[model samples]
Structure formats: C-alpha cells, structure tokens
Target: MNSKHQILVIGAGTGGLMMASRLKKEHKDFDIAIIDPAKTHYYQPAWTLVGAGTYDFEDTAKPMADLIPKGVKWYQDKVTAMDPDSNSVSTEKSGEIKYDYLVVSPGLTYDMSLVPGLSEAIDKGNVCSNYTDPKHTLEVLKNFKGGTALFTQPTTPIKCGGAPQKIMYLAEAYFKKHGLKDKTNVVFATNGTVIFAVPEIKETLMKIVDRKNINLKFYHALKRIDAEKQIAWYELAPEAYEHNPAKLEIEKEGNMVGIHYDMLHLAPPSVAPEFVRKSKLANAEGWLDVDHHSLQHNKYPNVFGLGDVAALPTAKTGAAIRKQVPVVLDNIEKLMKNQAADNKKYNGYSSCPLVTEYGKMVLAEFDYDNKFTPDPELKKMLIFDSSKEHWRLWILKKYGLPYLYWNKMLKGQDV
Candidate 1:
C-alpha cells in the first residue's frame, strides 16, 4: 500500500525466503517486502526421492502463505520489470514499488526450446522428467516394461547438478526391485567429461556405476528426440568429434548417435527467468551478475543476488544458497550501517548428497577449488569421510535436511 520499502526481495523460492525470514529476525524495524506469485513453495530436492517412489510428493510442498515471514509485506504479483537504475520495480498489478535495496533470487526457468523436440518429448510417452512433474515420472516408471533406461542432462546449467543422475540411480533400484534390472540397460549420457568433479566423490560414484552396471557416456549431449520413433539423438562433444571417434560406439549411426530407449528421463535446458534475463541486472549469460565471493551485484552496491539466478561458478543448489544468504545479509547490514567496503565472503561452498542407491548416500561438499572439503563440524562429529557411501547420509537426505529446511532455515533459526 505504501508503494515503497527499505528492502525488497524477488522470488519466494529457497534463497529468497531464507533471506527474507532471517532479515525479519535480525532487522525487525526495517520495512521489508517480498514479491512473488507462487501459491506453494516446494522442497525440490526431495523430488529426486519422489520420482523413485521413495518419498511422498505431497510432503515436498507447503503453502507459500505459511512460509513468507510475518510483517514482511507480501506482494502476491509477478514482477514485470526490474529497473535497478531507478531503484524501483514494476509489478503486473501493483504498479511501481521502490526499494533502497533489492535482492534478486528469482531462480531460473526451463528453456524447453534449447533442444528442438524437448518441449514435445518431455512427459510424453516414454520420456519423463522429474524436474517437471515427479508424480508423472513415478507413473512412467510404474509402467516401464524394461529395455534401455537412459538418463541425460542438458548442456546448460540446471539446479542440483547431480539431480539427473540421482533419479537414474533410484530408478535403477526400482528396476532391480521389480525384476526388470536384468532386462534393462541403465545409461547416463551427460555432456560433462567426468561423473563428478570432486575426486573422492567420483571414485565413490564410479564404484556405484560399476555395481549397477550403469553406463556413463560423458561428452555426449542430447541433440534431439524423436518421440514417435522412441529415438534420442545425441551430438558428440568436441573430444569425441575431433579427437576420439571411439567415444561413441561405432555400431551406432554416424555423426549423431541415435539411441533407442524404453524410458528417457532428463534435466532439460534451463536459464534465468525471463524477467531476470531481460532485466538490466542480468549478466551476458542472462543471470544476475554478482561478485562470486560477496554475493553482491558487480555494478550496483545496493543490489544483491543469490540462489539459482546468480551467475556464480559453483553449482546452483540450495546448499550453495545456505552459504550465500549470510554473506548477502552481512553486506546488506553493513550498507545499512553506512559501513563501506566491509563485507563477508562466501567460499563458494556447496554440498550435494549423492544418493548412490536406496539406503546409501555419498556427501560431496566442496569450495571454489573443487577440493573435497567436508564440513569440518560434520567431519568431526558425524561421519568422518563424506565421500564414502553412508547409510546415515541417506537418512539425512530422507529426513534431516527437510526438517532443517522447514524448521530452521526458513524460520530464521541458526540450528
């Protein structure tokens, strides 16, 4: 109603809500507002479990109304334009709202058009994607008769870098459970050159790949899919194209390898939201241009960005956001206090709980250098080595993280 605020946050996803709730707890006197049209906030990390039928879909979501921090005015409308130069944002119905500081964590959107037939093939027939609808993926898995069970990801960045593979591992377990493992060929064809970046984690995953007999076709990017013909064509990576022709099986069609599949699950190409991509705050890559260490905008001192929307070198994950939020908060508080250039730095820390199989998980925690830096606290108190498959890690994924997210992170509690 005031058409103004001291600080305004965009999006109501993980990063946006976390920042807002904590700001509320610390700066109760500051007039803050958040703009988002979402009715329900989802714990998307659990969808990997949901797709495997290991977790309930309903448990992954909560009404957004219950989560947005109290006293932080909520604008239940989408942002049409973000004019940071003018220090104002235009909403679809609320007209213009001004802010002294803007927090952009609107997250990314699926660019289904990246691959020609991706829009038509996703969630259609044998093609299923947990990113779009985990429930639909479950149904697709239920009716899977058995053959080539292939999983792949887009060349572009996607939230949860390991998500595409997480489902593959879980689905493999499903196949083994229903006596279809013998008849099915499990394959992961990714554009990434390695199974995982961290060495210890990669070693752990490589073992799982061997045990499950899952195929890993690195340097293979999905080019297109012929839904009617049950064919998924792939373009070989540069290494395969110019150097190693043996990278692809010679028996397959030349140039583009067209593989036949019974089921295809993939992470589609994703980009910053249209509103963020088109805004002045976005980088050339269409993501918010923020300092990798401070989580502050490169050009604007009063503007901050985080979550999947920020163009940071680390993986776009909720775990990364956990480290980023505090840095953003500290910098914002310093600015509010007229403290110049005094800021906190994020070490680009992010964690990915790689669920190798049912009752088994490998925690991959690292910094900017791709070092296998386990959480010092966890390494000392919890399990010693995070890279090894631990049943306790599986419990953390299934129960611990979700409980912490809803109770601690969003509620502005440190623990």
Candidate 2:
C-alpha cells in the first residue's frame, strides 16, 4: 500500500520511539508513522544485568504496541530499502511509502559470521554472548568450573561500548560470589589499549581491575573461536607491542594468541542493517551519514538519524539518544517553520554505568572529546563525583535508569 506521512520514522527503537513520542506530544496534529516489524521492544541496556543473573530477562521487554505513543501511528513492517533522494522508503509488507521528512534510526545488527564459529558455538557450551543470548551467559557463569575465563570484544563498534567490559566485571563478581575467584584466571583481551576512553572513568576501572587482579591484554582483537576445542584465537595489533600484523604458521610464530578457557564470554561483532548500509544515506562505514551535532542527514536536510545506526564518532547508546532526540526534534521544528537550526547541537554526550562489582558502579559520562563530564544535575542531586565507584550509582543503574527509560523517556516526558 502506497502512503505518505508528514514525518516517517523507521525503527521503534530508543531513537525512533523517543522521536515519535516527543514529537507527538508537542505536535499532536502532525501525521507521524513509525515503522518496525517487532512485536516486542527489548531494553538492551539491561541485558548486561541479565547476563550477570541480577535482572530477569523478561523484565527488559514490553509489548511494542504498549510503548508506541498515543496519536502516533505504528506500522508493523520492516524497512527493506531507504531512498532519501526520493524521500521514500520500501517496506517488506507495505509498498513504497513516501514522506516529507524521514527519521532513519534502524539500529545495528549482529553477524556472528564476522567471527568464525561464533554462530555455531552460541549457547551450545561455554561460548556465550550477552548481546546474543544473555540468559545463556547466566548459565555459563553458573556452570563455570574455574579456569581461564576469557572476556573479549571485537574491533567493530557494538551496542554500548562499555557493554563488553560491563559483563566482564559482572562475570568476575559472579566468580567471586561462587568462590571461583582463586581458581579462575580472569583475562580481558580487548582491542583497545585503554580501559575506557574517558580518563577519569579509565582510572577508576583500572583501580577495579587491579583490585580484582584481572589481567589486561591490550590490543588483542578476537579473530576466531574454536568452540569445540574450547580455544579462542586472537590477533594482536602491532601498535601495542611495536611489531607488525603478521601471520606465519603457528601461534608462537604469528601475531595470534590462543587461550583455552573453561568459560568464555564475548560481545559479537555488529554492524548497521544491510538495507541502510546499501542506501545512499549510508556513510563510508555503512551507517547513516548524519551531522554529528544536528543529527540531520549530511546530504538531505529532510532526513535525521540517531541511536546505534548513526555513524557518530561516539558510543551507540540510549543515553546518547536522550541528548540526541531533543536536538533532532528541535531541528525538525525549525526546518518545518524556517528551515534553519536554532543552535541546538548535540555534544555527543553518552553515559555508561560501569558496574565494577555486584554492588558498586561508576557513572562514566563524556562528550565528543572524551572529556569526563558528569551530569551536573545528577551531581547536584545524587553523587558529586562519578569517577569513583559508588553503591548509589549501582542503585540508579539497577532501578532508576530503567524507570526513566519507560516512564519518562518513552512516555513523552523530558528526561
């Protein structure tokens, strides 16, 4: 069915749902329709907590129909193609749908093929990923017999840059809880040299790492996994050791390191959806190419993007979208009225609640420059310093954030 809307939003995710909810609240008369095929919308941020066995997986989701804001139309259809030049999109069930303005925020997807054996090994034995199957992560952690427990992330950008480490910290805490701490060799093999981009947060995480005695193997990118053999192979980046990326015959001769593990938890490599990647809206990296500040398409002003789909040089997070939604909504209003921006630019603000242990957390907030800028309002009301691990922050993470997400953010209240 061919249809046209004043504002067409893709994906009822944090970006799409919030955009529709906020806009509908202010501009009730506007014709807005959101497209998403899913029946349930999952709060992915809480998956880390689920993997740690603290939060129930079922609590992380709700009926998408329940969350769709009143007065906003919802289309249970998947986006197969996006055509910004024509200001239209093609859906799986629906035919070509035209729009005056398009909001492209179809979130990223994971491809286990990016890493060998990742798909086959998922949830079968000790191999588990919080992003894919968080429930199985809980099982893996519970069944751990205490050996080398390796946690790693791919080089490709994944949902919430801190997620990989969050699960790592939680798994370590779980091991400690089960009295497996002494027998377990907790190794964090990450592609990055630093614990975190933000300096203050990095310092805090480092302290936690030292206290837990977790070994940090810097610049180690997960290349492949032999799940059957219970071995994970990693490729070492040359910059870390001042060598070159080389592959010879064996692990000792090459830049590869294989570690056998009794338990392995990993964050799978993820990328933008194929439809957005092949479209004209995509950047060189296959993500929606939008102005980082305005969240407007670089080439098409009628288009806006946010959330994990946007190719911004920052973490893909719901916290980032909280800041981005206002900028996008403000700009959309201005463009409709005068086709000009009112200095409403996003500062690339994203916050990650790094759960160091079962009871402590560090609220790592930062901007485009990786500056550790804590929320002044939070500091004034809650904790003054977010650089240190605090039980109060953990309480906020486990309870407060989810409340704000559903009742405040999705319910069309200012967050």
Candidate 3:
C-alpha cells in the first residue's frame, strides 16, 4: 500500500531509531514511521570487546522489534530509491511511501571486494575482521600461536577510525596473556600518516604503539589478500596528486608490497549505501546532502540526516549519533513550530573509545575541528583526562556505554 506520513525515517538504525523514539515521545501527535528490513539491531561498539573475548557476541544484538519505539509504525522493507523532490521513497517490499518530512539514515555498506581475494578469505581462515564478523575474529585471536600478525586499516573511511588499532592493541594484550608476545611480530598498517587525527590523542596512541613494540606502516592501503599464500598485498599511497575531477593520477606500478602473516585483521573500505549514492539527494561525494551543522538537507529543507551516511567531516561512530540525535530532533521541532532552525546547530561532535589494552582506554571526544571536547560530568568523574588510558574509561566503554545506549539513548534519554 502506498502510504503517506508526517515523517518517514528510511532506516531503523541508531540515528533513525533514536530520532523516531525522541520524536514520538516529544511530539505524540506526529505520525512517524521507520523502514528497515533487518530483524536485528546490533550494538556495534561492543563488537570490539566481543572480538577481544571481553564481551559476548550474543550481547551485541537485540531484536529490531524490541528496540523500535512503541507508537511509531515499523515497515520491514528495504529502501530501493528516493524521490526527494516529491518526498517519497521506494522500497523493495513495501512499494512507495510519501512523507511531509524525511529522515535519511540508511547508514553505510562495506566493500570487502575493494581488495582482491579479501571477500573469499574473510571470516574463513586466520584472516578475519571485527567489522564483518566478531565471532570469527574471536576465533582468530583465540587460536593465535605467535608469529606475524598484521592489522590493517583501509584507505577509505571506516565506521570507527580507531577500530583497526583497537583490536590490534587487544590482540597484543592477548598475546601477552597467552605467552605468545615474544614470538608474535605485531604490525599496524594504515593509509594515514598518524595514529589518530587529533594531535592530542595521536600523541598518546603513538606512545602505546611504541610501548607495545608494534610495527607501524604508514601509507599502506590494502589492495589484495592472497589467503592461500598467507600473504597480503598493499599499495603505497602516492605523494603527488593531480586535481582530476573523476579519477586520481597516480603511479600504480612499483608501489605494491607483500607481507606474510600468521593472522590478519582488516578494516575494509566503507561507503554510503548504493541507494543513497545513486539518489539525487546525495552530495557530490555520494553521501546524504545535508548541512553538516543543522543535520538538515541543504537542498531539501524537509529532509534531515545523521549517521555514517551523512556527509559530515567527522569520524562515524555511535557516540556521534548520541549528540546528533538531539540536534536533528530540535531542528525538526523547530520546523514543526514554523521557526528557523539556524540556532540549532551540531558541532560535528564524535568520539572513539580507544581501548589501549584489556582494562585501559583513552576516551577521545572531539568537535568539528578535532578539538577534544570533554563532557563536564564525565570529565569530573573520569578525572578530566580524555587522552590518557584509564581503567575508568575502559569501564565506561565495556559496561556503562552499552547500558546507556540501550536504556537511555534508544529510549530518547540524554546521556
């Protein structure tokens, strides 16, 4: 049935679910609906701990039916396309649905095929990724008998930029626990030059890298995975660049390097869902064309977005969704009241709980310019250190944050 509503959220993800929950609670009269085909919602942040054997895999998931707001209708359908000019979206199972206001938060998709042989090898051999399957990663980590272990971060933006290394740190700690540290040669390969974007946090992560005695290979982006050979191929990021509109001019030859590994964990390239990229509502870079501040669509005022699918120049993480939820709701409320949404602005706040070890983490929080913006209450409770590894922060990550996410954030309660 082709239906119309006051608000239609395209995905029942963190951003979409949180937005619906808040709106339904705040403005009870608004007819809001969320569409997603998935039957389970995952607490992805906990997957890192799950991969490390600290958290349970079963604990990382909840039935989507349990998490959807009580009043908002759920459309168990996949979105196929959007007609933003007419405020309607097409779905694979449910056909076309129109809305007065739309929230586009379908999130992102992983391109494991971006690297040759990765798709065939992942979650099958000693090769695994916490991103794709935490259970397999747990298996990989548990079976390690010491040797060359390499953790890789792709050239494209990933869900949590720190995830590639978070598992590396945990695996290192695991090696120590299993008496395999001395024999294991741990390596972290990334396309970026620094461990982190924020200088303060980068400095601390650098120290952790040094203390762990892990090899850091900068400008290395995964290009191929020869699982049969137990070798990984990478291309060195080119130094010179030509401002080609379509493709980059690079010297592709002589830049490839191959490394053998006993075990490997990789963060594959991620991009906005294919539907969002192909839609007219997307920005030049194939993300939702929303204002980075207001979380509102620049061209279509009735459309708003927040999450990995949105074109915000910040790290994509669930923590960012916590801050972004309120901003988007406030602006939507403003729109409801016929008031300008100019004052309601999001400063691109995002966070990465850098788990340095089994019991220590550096809670890195920052705003638009990558400035560390600590929460006053958390700072006071955590002794105001967001860049240093602390047990309290680890506790927050392991136990506290997940509780807050399920009990508060999903219920529209501010953390």
Candidate 4:
C-alpha cells in the first residue's frame, strides 16, 4: 500500500522520536511517520551508571509503544533503502514510504568485528561494553573481583566520547567500595593523546587520574584481545609523516603491544548503517551529509539528519540532540510550507557529564569551536563550583534527566 507523510523519520531513536513529537504538536495536520526495527526504546545515557552497577539495565529501557507520541504512525521495521531523490524510504517489512521532508536519525552502527579476537573475548568471559545492550553489564561487573582491568576507547568516533572513561572511573570506585582497590589495576588505553578534548575538563580529569592512580596510555589503539591468555593487544599510532598511502604503515609507529587483563570494557568503532552509507544523501565517510549550522542536507533539500549518524563536527551525544531537535523541526516545517528555511544556527552545543567517580563529575559543555558554555544559573545560583562532582549533579544525571527525557523532551515540552 502507498503511504505518504509530510515528514518521515527513519528511526525512532532519541533524535527522531523527539523531532516527530515536536512536529506533531506544532502542526497536527502535518503527516509524520516513524520507522524503527525494534519495539523498545532505550535511555542510552544511563548505561554508564548501569555498567558501574549503580543502575539496573531494565530501568534504562522502555516500551517504544508507550513513549511514541499518539497520532503519529509507527512502522516496526528496519530501513532497507533511502531514496532521497524521490523523497521516499523503503523498509524491510513495510513497503515504500513517501515524504515531503525526511529526518534521518538511524544512529550509528557499532562494528564489534573490527577488532581481532574482540568478539570472542567479549562473548567468553569478564568483558562488557556499555555502548551496546545494557542487560549484560551487571553480569560482567559481578565477575570483576580483582586483577588488571582494562578499558579502551577506539580511534573511530563513538556516540558518547566520555562513556569509556566514565565506566573506568566507576570501575575504580567500585573496586574501592568492594575493598579490592588495592588488588585491581585499572587502566584506560585510548587512541587520543589527552583524556578529553576540552582543555578545562581534561585538566580536571588528569587530576582525577593522578589521584586515583589510574594508568593512562595515549596513542594506543586496541588491535586484538586474547580471552584465554587475558592479554589485550594495542598498536601505536604512526608518526605524522609516516602515513604514506603508497606503503603499508602497520608497523611504522612500532611493534604491537599487549596488556594482560582480568576484565575488559570496550567502546567499539561506530559508523552509519550500510543503507545510509550507500545512499545518495550520505557523505563519503558514510554519515548523513548535513550543514553544521542548518542541519539540512547539503545536496538534497528535502532531507535532514541529526544525532550520532549525522556528519556534524561536534560531540555525538543526546545532549547535542536536545539542542538540535528545535533547529531540525523548524527548518523542516519551513520547507513543508514552501518557504525558505530560516537561518537559525546551531552553535554545536553538546554536553558530557564526565562522571570521574561515584559522586563526582566534571560537567563538560562545549560547542564546535571548543569554547565552554556553562549554564548561567549554575554560576549564579551555586556557591560551589559546578564542575566539581556534587550530589545535586549526580541526581540530575541519574534521576532528573530520565524524567525530563520521557515526559518533557519526548513530549515536545522543552525546559
């Protein structure tokens, strides 16, 4: 059967769901349809706490049918093809859906198979990843008694940059609480030279690393894992000039190294899904090609995208999506009216509450320019430093944010 909508959302994830709810509320007559493969909706930001054993995995997920806005059509199927030129998307189960405007937020694809032996190691024993399914987090944490615990962040861009290190800090605190801090050697091995991209936040993080005695390794990319030997292999980044496309530069930096570990937490490489990557609307790097400020497709006027899958040069987080939803909704609405889209710009605002320990967090808020944009009331209302880990902020991340996401953000009610 032929289906058409004023706005077609390709995914029912945070970005798509938020935009659809907003559009439906703003204009009831505007037809909006959301397509997602799964019937469940997840609060992904809470996964970090789940990995730390602070939250139950079940609490972080919800029934999609309950959260999706009433009146908007929901198609429970995966997007098989995106035909932006014809303003239509084909789903695996449902047939073609035509649209006047399209909002693509399918999210990134986690490539767990990229790292050799990683799949086996993660499936075999005390290994976990907070980025994927949260159900297994508790089981993995329960087995961690002692020994060298390794946490890794890949070179590829991930949804939440701070999540890998956030779990590491939680693991450190968990060990202390369990009276096993002395027995466990916690290490953070990442491809980045610094702990975080923001200088202010990085300063605080470095101090935490020093105080906690957490081993930090830079320029180290996880190459493989050995579950039996409990050895995690890493390859150093090649020197700047050594990156000659003509030659194989695998060992230009040095020989691959290994770190023995009893438990491992990994953040895998992520990319746009193959369907979006092969579509005409996507960039060469396989992400939805949209203008950084406008959130509109560079080539296709009818297409727009946001969230982790969009080619926006900012931190890919739900916090960024909060700021982006309004921009995407407004621009698409303007296009639907046969008017030129307004020039409402996005400042690349994104936030990451760097939970260094159980009670402490370095609130890292910045934009595309890497300039800090702190909340004005945070500076005025609070006597204590907002950057420091406070019980108030912890409650905000743990309890307050989830409520805001479901009841407010998903309902088109903005704070």
Ranking of candidates on TM-score, top first: 2, 1, 3, 4
lDDT of 3 by residue, 1-415 (tens): 7999999998888888889999998889889999999999999999899999999999989999999999899999999899999889999988899999999888899988788898899899799999989999999988889788888977788898889889999999999999998888888777787778888998898888888888787777778888998888877777522111111112334878777888999987788998899998898888889888888898899999989999999999988989898888888788889987774568889999999999999988998899988778776664577788899999889999999999999888887
Output the lDDT of residue 329, model 4: 79
lDDT of 4 by residue, 32-147 (tens): 89999887889889999887878888887899999778889999888899998788898887889999888999999977677878777664468778887555656666777888
Model-by-model lDDT, in order?
Answer: 0.87, 0.87, 0.86, 0.81
lDDT of 1 by residue, 165-252 (tens): 9999989999999999888888888888899998889998988888888877878888888888787888886685221111222225
- How many pairs in model 1 have backbone atoms within 3 A of each other, for residues 3 or more apart or on separate chains, i.e. clashes? 0
Candidate 3 local lDDT, residue 46: 91
Q: Could you tell me every candidate's TM-score relative to the true structure?
A: 0.95, 0.96, 0.95, 0.93
User: Mind giving the per-residue lDDT tens digits that candidate 2 earns over 208-271?
Assistant: 8888888777888888888888888888878754121222222442878787777888888999
Candidate 2 vs 3: which has more TM-score: 2
lDDT of 4 at 335: 81
Candidate 2 residues lying further than 4 Å off, grouped into runs, are 241-253, 342-344
Error of 2 at 26 (Å): 0.1
Q: What's the lDDT for residue 37 in model 2? A: 96
Worst 10 residues of 3 by lDDT: 241-250
TM-score of 1: 0.95
For residue 208, model 1's alpha carbon misses the true position, in angstroms, by: 0.8
